[model samples]
Target chain A: MVESSPPTRLDALLDQLATDLEPVKPLDDRPTALVLAGLFAAAVALVLAWLGPRPGLLGEDVQPMFMLRSGTLAVLAVVCVAAVVAQAHPGVGRNSQGWKVAAAMAALFPLVGAVVAFTDPAHARAMMMMPTGWQCLRMSLMTGTLCAVPMVLHLRRGAPVAPERAGLLVGLASGSLGALAYNLHCPFDSVVYIGLWYGVAIAVAAVAGRLVVPRLIRW
Target chain B: MTSDEATLARLMRESQGGNAQAYRQLLGLAAPLLQRWFRRKVAPHELDDLVQDTLLAVHQRRASWDPARPFLPWLAAIARYRWVDRLRRSALRNHDALFDDISVESGESALIGRLGCDRLLALLPAGQAAAIRAMKIDGLSVTEAAAQLGQSESMVKVNVHRGLKKLAAMVDEDA
Candidate 1:
């Protein structure tokens, strides 16, 4: 049998590795998963923003419960979209040397905004406009967490995934989850704008993923 | 009556002048460091081959060894390049392994290296915990790790970094 060869499995592996192979070369997905779960909160911010200012709180804090700020909403959306694209294609666009750039950019947006908010909460608050700051942060955190979950799984899988498809899946899943959770805080009296619109955006992205994922997958 | 330094210098000059004995002595002196370096990097199976390659390169390019320069650094440089070449050549298949047979310093005589284990153990997830133990306790290379876990080399490396980062962060956080 082939198993009975003089070279043991490790011997063969080492022989191949020494003669030919080569070397070249994510984060922990669990915390990212829980954080991802917060995209559900992306719901409350987007919906309330467009529905004219319904400031509801997640907790009992009735101090104008405008947690998911519009700025955060946009950040979450962009991150979600990036995640979707990454998921769809997996490793496709990565070796381009610009992946670190994209990753830095994706990671930078929130930190910059957070710093901006810290510098001048009043002006920052004014520019942020929507009473959705907390919600939006939660959304970004959630979507990041959510998209990161599957991405972690993908990394752990170690089978090559199409980078673009990976991104798409990340974005769509994060978006949808953000919409659904955020919607729970929706006030029945006013129309839930984000709950409706963002939900549709995420759903559309998911369907697009369906199309893209198929194309991305090897036959 | 020549000092080791003079003898070493003479040997270097002689090796450069194509003295096979001088070349052999230079290689004899350099072998330990190269072997150790390669041993840390590759599977047990690949370690000798790589070390041989490193020595062969050193011999082939004997002129590159500047007499004014300290020898170890030059040899280390050779080892590093050889290591990089090995990594690049195996990029596709090895990309999935985690540690890639790099021997951890704690591996030998690690049974006595009890200082970091308790704290390190506190930080690791299951797989990383095991890896640190194997590297520290059992003294296996990253390739042996793949064999142990039935995973890829890149995956092993990834896990090691993640585990290491976590361990480092835990130490920092604790501090």
Candidate 2:
């Protein structure tokens, strides 16, 4: 019986498989979307604290400075972002404690935000209605949250589908969604410039999210 | 009230019967696993599309899953098919058996394709090949891959976090 030439070695086999995929670019700039979001979340919360409650609908009464209270919620959002990032990482939940930590953090974002908003809504009202940059900041904050939403959704779905343009997609969704949802209630200031269509500007920030989140996380 | 044999297994069964609640539950249950699996295979960015497609497939063909079997194996089959599809699109579809291809090439040029990637690649969960392909070959910015694939950039980042480690291990094994 003729024996075939000796089979190739396994070591040699894998060596043949390597190609110019290159080491991932250093994570220096990547994955910043979440961190910046966290930072922004905290910053927005801080601004609200200084500004005092978010505005009420239809321009109701204003309230006292309640930055500290809102700060708690903002802090909670940052923690939740970190924890969610961790939770989203593989194998962390198997440890049980990691799951609890992540769950707690996730639960806390809205929880703390709600508690502060309810316990002393004046700050939320003030911040919401300030007419100053607060409105835009609030919008940005919400936009960030929206951007994060799909990522969380993607994770829960359990397949890494973001093969390309993750940050851009996030930014676009956030920008359009934020603009669409918020612009509905826009004061429009009687100029009726809605036709001027400035809402598209929000896409820039969403684009930023697309670039930033992946780098920091380096997925 | 299905007792846990892992979250997806129970939900997969219920979802097959067209239970939206069960399907939603299955989506949640499957999400993290899919994220981790895809992350391991590809860059952090591509994860979003991978998850999106997988979920859409699961939702679209929920009936194909047989609850009588282990959820993971079925999911594994789904994942494997996805990987193969991706491999064919990229350059990694293996025409030769692992043993057969080992000796045909040499030199650093050939070394790119010949590096003991299989040893380390096998060490990783099978799903991550897609991730590796996106980052390495397709030259996608992680953000681009993440958005296209419908996953968190961070999730994608974490999945490919260990390439250097895996490579190091392979190098050590080779030595």
Candidate 3:
């Protein structure tokens, strides 16, 4: 079946490849990937249900600050997930700038916390001494880790040109999802606590993803 | 999209649907295009292997392509990834003779013609790019590269490794 007047090795190889070809389902689109990631969210919900919601999340008296923070985290996690999904298909989605903007917006929580700490010595000490901060950190990371498993597995299904960035996105999305999951149970709503604990947890998750995910997903 | 691009997209759509003839035609057309693409980026001796490697990658990763999108950019992205990967491995292997006396004829096409070593190097940090340029492209000894760049010998090695690593990570973005 070689058509060239003088067949080359590549033509032979090409023929071999074509002979072995079979129908393949294309990789999942962005929505499908998001839904796959969402399946893990149910695990987060189960854990939250076991732990019990932050006492009053469902009640009318819930703080608007809590709603605002949780909303921000939810949006950030979705954006990160979308960005990571785009990584699987090269040239399909090249909007690397989208996640950066979302990340910057998310950073404002920690930035405000830093400003509060630096500007007011008394409140800074109170924020540092808060008893539940470490617990929030642990739970957030645990939640994120749960979300991360499926995301990593999802990324492995395709060829990611930037494995490191994709790994980081996996970490960020899962970490934020983790924070959101734990936010339903966490009692602390202060900008200082959320900033310090959630920020560190997400940062740790992102760093861990960057370091580890590439090795797992590299093609 | 051009007529060729449209034809390629159609062929790929057929290939995904389990049409072997379309797949063969797709690969047949793709092989020469990849050869021209890699010509400017790789040594002449390495060109054929790189093209084959890329063709194989395209076959392996064909599922990642969406029928709605134009085919060439996806092909280009995969090609760039393979090119960077080949360079990274070669850089790690430290094959001194591979790059020697390398000269490439200019390619006639659009997207592939724009890529060259200079453009590839520009993606890295200045320090890393300089180190790769001296040690890999210029074939300088580590000691010579260190002296030329005015840094410790250890730094040159570090920069080259980091540069190659960064190049692999950034390949997807170039498309």
Report per-candidate DockQ.
0.02, 0.03, 0.55
lDDT of 3 by residue, B1-175 (tens): 2228889999899998899999998898887777667665655567889989989999999999888777887887788788878877777676555355655455365645443335667878899998877875566778888999997999999998999887876676653
Residue A211 lDDT in candidate 2: 70
On residues A1-219, what C-alpha lDDT tens digit does candidate 2 reach at each position?
A: 011456333222222222211222111212444544554545445444544434542244322212222233244333433433322222211212232343244344345545666666676465345463346446644655554664544433332223123344444434433433343234432111221222223445446666765454322
Candidate 1: tens digits of C-alpha lDDT, residues B1-175: 2213456567666666555555455455555445544553455556677777766655444444555545543454445445444543543343332344444564533321212224445557887766654543344577887789766867776766666546433321221
Please identify model 2 stretches exceeding 4 Å from their true place.
A1-158, A165-169, A172-198, A211-219, B1-175
| lDDT: worst 10-residue window of model 3 chain A | A88-97
In Å, residue A20's CA in model 3 sits off its true spot by 0.4
Q: Which tens-of-lDDT digit does each residue in A1-219 have in candidate 3? A: 324478878888998999999999888766556665576568567657777778678888888888988899989988998888777787723537688889999999999989887888788789778777787778878768877776777677777877888999988988888888888888877788778888988899999999999999988
Give me candidate 2's TM-score against the actual structure: 0.28
Give the candidate number with the greatest lDDT.
3
Q: Tell me, by TM-score, which candidate is best.
A: 3
The TM-score obtained for chain B by all candidates, in the order given, is 0.51, 0.50, 0.77
Candidate 3 wrong stretches, greater than 4 Å: A1-5, A30-41, B1-3, B98-109, B113-118, B125-159
